[model samples]
Target: MPKLNLSQSPAVRAKWEENLKLDSQEKVTSSQQQLPNSAALTPQCIEKRWQVIAERTNKAALLDTDSEKQQNLYSSNIEHFIGTVKLPVGLAGPLLVNGAHAKGEYLVPLATTEAALVASYSRGAKLITEAGGVTALVINEGVTRTPVFEFANVTKAGEFVAWAVTEYEQFKQLAHSTTRYGKLKDININVEGNRVYLVFEYLTGDASGQNMVTFATNTIYQYIIQSCPVDIHSCYLDGNLSGDKKPNSHTMRSVRGKKVVADITIPAALIEKRLHTQVAKMVEFGQMTTTGSLLSGGIGVNAHYANALAALYIACGQDPACVAESSIGITRMEQNAQGDLYASVTLPNLMVGTVGGGTHLPSQKACLDILGLYGSGNARALAEVTAGLCLAGELSIVGAFCAGHFSRAHQRLARR
Candidate 1:
């Protein structure tokens, strides 16, 4: 292919000249028409730009600001902020959680636009609450960050892996040195030819430690570069081995954020009265769905965990994107001898925290406060509630499907 001279093209000449002037630090003549002023598109600048455009377009209320309450919120959290995009946040519960830490009737704030979502969850919450609430257990807690290193050959990569295992204490010390709240818990080694992925798992206290583990891993990476026994050809921060914000089989088996199991046993009579479905039907539905999920080679077998996770995460100031992985889990429904329904959800990766990220935002914090999950020390409680809420949602949605009321309910509520 021949290279075309962009300088000869009038369309490209102006941009090329501007780039050359920028590179050479040459001042353009004042007679030259300057580019529109866009120095750091702050909220003020964005508002001004919108106003100018509105004047030309006869558009009213297009650039209005309802963020008089947000003047103090835009420091480092965001840039180019005009106003907050409002989602219709609805209160769903009085969800009674019988967990190790979270034991109470707490109102769940759910931010969603989907009609009947909150109503469905609320119906489930009522069933659980009346049935003495859902029991939630936090089985494990650890956040992981993986960094990949390349060696000359497989032999060197294997050697590096062995060295990493031996120098675990040193790596832990280096990782822990970066943050006061984060502690290095475990290191997993994965080898592929001349490449090695060092999966660093950490206990990030009170905060969902994506950023925490990243910074800690950077320190460990520096240490590995300085002290590795083998010569490394290249090193990259994440090799997608940590499975951050993506579905992975390992995250489903092992702990990612807070491995939580929530369960509730509803009597046959109550299932008939509340869910309008028999225990046997719900159990059969579970079996069919689970088999279908297994046949599809899915990571977890569940009905719409993302619906609950996303709504709750957004309402409660969590890393909403983490729902991608956090929603991966199993929902089991079994029929007992007495015809009672034993339903449980195992959320192996419920990535949540009470601090950091958008948890401090005004609306998000208010929502967290509604669950009593604001600030520090309530991360475990938050995890438990999150898991319990998920179970409630699954039960409701699955029951809706089983009872053949899913479409009817949507048609009735969603249309309005």
Candidate 2:
């Protein structure tokens, strides 16, 4: 819950206008330092904010059109995402990013472009292995519950859903001590198979909804099986998958985690030969500036913030820390018909969440909310958008290495 002294909306609006007037004269400072981790705006509010930002920018080209924002986002077709399930929440932080993860170790270059998060993790992995390398094994997993709720049967599933559908104040009262539930979430249920599923969309507030979703769903599931009036028969919690680990709706269980895919292309020549060096060089560039080194700074503008926006997704949400999958970039060199070298780059994973974890930090949430890309639906979409932004950035860099004039568009917008 954010507190706003909107005792004076008009005054606040005036200051915003004044700030724009002042910013117009200066080089628009790089937003890396200014923007927060997230925001709380709904899609509609996000649009309005961008309209205001457009006015401030005084440029049609730079205006953040909603479609452009949406264009950067990706997701499975609506049908695949039409259903969902819940799983027990888990916590894995207190991540001592700036130093030793727990007290006595090495100093870290966190909060910098050159941070070495993966490198540090690798060192930690090395210490655990005797033969200089460690092997990872498959661990068991389960889905917490798979019950869908409509306007009715709220109580049967668990208290969280039961209360949210009621009046707002009643919900507020019930949520008073809610460790995590519906403040930053919503429920949309669609039935499939013999199961009634609950699409548990929660805004874990901050700290990634991991703990919040697990407990809330687990508590609710237990209540449903024990108290609900319907014939549950043998309810299964895997939502869409199954076996001995199946869980009944409204009870605690777990899922094998969401599937995240990333793709990249470097010309065959690049992949088969010399350009591997280029790719390695770029990877070196990423590592040199990632979140675990002192060189986190001086990595140039926007790069650190861009990586932060992406890395935060894996760290807080469900990526299982695929720093390597995301540790990708592409480079291309080709001959145009007229004979000039044409080159390009693409990065496809780069996950980012607009609403979960520290996204709600005063400024962060404001950033997410302003974009209207918060919460679950948006979380999935944001991962795609962040990837697109990075891909675009990568392309922009490659273009500069070849075609030239990367900032021309920005300058054109500034003139507008």
Instruction: Please list the C-alpha lDDT of all candidates, in the order they appear.
Output: 0.86, 0.35
> Can you write out model 1's per-residue Cα lDDT over 119-219, one digit (the tens) per residue?
99988888899999999999999999889999999988888888889989988888878999999998888899999998889999999989999999998
* Cα error, candidate 1, residue 362 (Å): 0.6
Model 2: lowest-lDDT 10 consecutive positions? 92-101
Q: What is the model-wide C-alpha lDDT for candidate 1? A: 0.86
> Hey, what RMSD does candidate 2 come out at?
21.3
Tens-digit lDDT track of model 2 for 1-416: 23335676998867866777676645455542242233432344445445445445444443235333432232311111111222222121212111111121111111222223333222322222211111111121121223443323434444434443453343233332456333423444544444456554443332334444455555555565565555455554335421112211211122222112222333334322422234344444444444433354321222322443334443233333433333343333344454322333233323234454455433334445433454554544444333333332343343322323335533553455
TM-score of each: 0.88, 0.28
368 Cα displacement, candidate 1 (Å): 0.7
Best by TM-score: 1
